[model samples]
Target: MNLFARCYCRTYQKVFLLARRFLDFSEPDLLEREGALKEDLPATLKMTGLDHFFLVISKFLFDKGVHLEMEKALKERGIVLTIYSDVDAEPTFDLIEKGVSLYKESGSQGLIAIGGGSAMDTMKAIGARIANPKKSLPKLGGVLKVTHMPPLMVAIPTTAGTGSEVTVAAVVVDKANHDKFSINDPKLIPDIAVLDGSLLASLPKSLIAQTGMDALTHAIESYIGHSGTKKTKKDALTAMKLIHEHLPSFYKDAKNVEARDAMLKASYLAGLSFTKAYVGYVHALAHAMGGFYGTSHGWTNAVLLPYVLKAFGKSAYKKLAEISDHLALTGKEANPQTKAAAVIAWIEELNETFGIEKNFAGILKKEDIPALAKHAEKEGNPLYPVPKEMNAKELEKILEETMG
Candidate 1:
């Protein structure tokens, strides 16, 4: 990185960190239990005085009828519910616009998103559009662009990843331009977050592995980043510890209620950490790849995380060593470099166990490396507060290694 750009990025991050002290970064009201969705969600909605609301879900979950009990409960309470399940794995601007139209036409006063990150993100983006009718979605991109609070949004995450329930970010794809970006603001945080472990019992093992790794990535990145507060660091460490102990057990047996609950708590803690401290190069690169190839965000993060950390090298060694100690991955006598290597090796081992490929290889086109690097650099610099500053050329070198 150039001297001028490095200085500017550091200054920008410092200013934001100082300003954050006065901001209200509140957590959502939690409804955590095995049957919260069916037993508690409806009554919670009634308490909010929401006579009508949109139930946002993915098509897969909708087809499975996973939310039937919740729907029945809402109907019994005389609360009008409009189901919108057209959300895709990677939500686009066009998709959000359609959801916004439906929301306005249905006279819905609130939103309840049930599914993975995509559904929650779609609902958040839709709420943003409805709140700020005059601003285009693209204009709402970057930090603090949302001037108005979204609707009374409730996020029920079926998968333990993305942490969209508590985070201040909604990632949206611009398919026409082949770009992906986040709409970030405190107002985008959901009013309530429901952690129902029963909803995750039917998830595929592959999905559990990917999303669990995604949560781990959030924890690691936030803990290692330059912008983390003491609270964020502690939250990240707790999340990492929970995931270390529970993710593998949950992956082996999806019906393990205790493990499932632990993973959910880990994911939420990771969200709370990253929403304040923010993520780094892995997320930036993952977003670029997802935009161009429509890759799964969690899987992409899983693949890119080790590579990014390795690239961070000595800059990340101390923090990574601390993480290794926190997770008890290495003995107390291990050197910082050795402990850092242990952390990376542990991630690689988990990926291998989950049947995740070590490299993009055949999936990533060599010709697109330049553009991908540019996109990552644009998204990361002066905003992410990464452990080590990297320019586009350096980022391109890292991308080349991922091709294997």
Candidate 2:
């Protein structure tokens, strides 16, 4: 058979595998048995900031709050919990060092990270460092570089984006050099993921918008990216459908717990999809921009999503057209380019609905375009399954357009 046929065959096989694995998803009775394991002494550590916020919220909600539930659950199991809050956004090498220092000082047996991607990544770095005490984080960059297994790590994501809670990757920055790199290891996937929407009720509107878009991007990119498998496509499409249905409503009505729960579930599904299929140009560019300017990843992607989708063009539009249908944008506009334009237009409209900017003018420097394009290409090519290979010159033009 031809290459395309072989790829489809593999995809079908994966779908069957996924169907078999779906049986494990129903575990209604497992929680009570876990209560039996309370004999093990608990030594859990999570990062600082959101935990404090969670504590304050826990007071009003009592047992309903995530922090309170966590404390109660740990207490039942006899686990001592510590909060390491020195972690900051755009977790630099220095910040990771501080976290590692704290983790060692605390001598915690396990980790419970509560926050956005930054806190989770910092916690992952510390877990890896604690497992392999002598190796530096920079040395752990790239795929499966971390051979040592970290302690039991549970992730409770406060934000509904990044899917870092379920993914097997951790990003760390070298602030001195404006370089961002990742540690990709299957072992890095969190042992537990808490998808409690109540945790997200306190998020600001801007955060809700940006992170929702981030989850949407993850689903779209995973669906259209070259690395897509049958299983990843299913996950991505499900996530896309959820985001399309609930994200805007959740953004407008933050108190809607049902919408919040759907968004969080969508984020988890998107995260799981991308972990296997990987992301493409949007994430590559967002990572570069964040590393260079300390910009927010979700907001950066929100700004660049439409432009990148347009550039993806014929190379990826077949898959994107399927996504347009998934978004319920079906009509007589059967042309691939037309469908792609419709998808981009829908995203542009979504951004406007959320008050996100269409340009990167103030955030991007003119002189830095070449460097930014070069770095983005270096990070994306061969690793990311970008449907169309983008050269520096072409990417420079995109940067210029983004600056508009």
The most accurate candidate by lDDT is 1
Model 2 TM-score, 2 decimals? 0.84
Query: Cα lDDT of model 2 overall?
Result: 0.74
Measured against the true structure, the TM-scores of the candidates, in listed sequence, are 0.98, 0.84
Candidate 2 per-residue lDDT over residues 62-96, each given as its tens digit: 33344545676565544556655555475678877
Model 1: lowest-lDDT 10 consecutive positions: 87-96
Model 2 worst lDDT window (10 residues): 26-35
Candidate 1 per-residue lDDT, tens place, 287-337, comes to 999999988999999999999999999999999999999999999999999
For model 2, the superposed segments whose C-alpha errors exceed 4 Å read 1-69
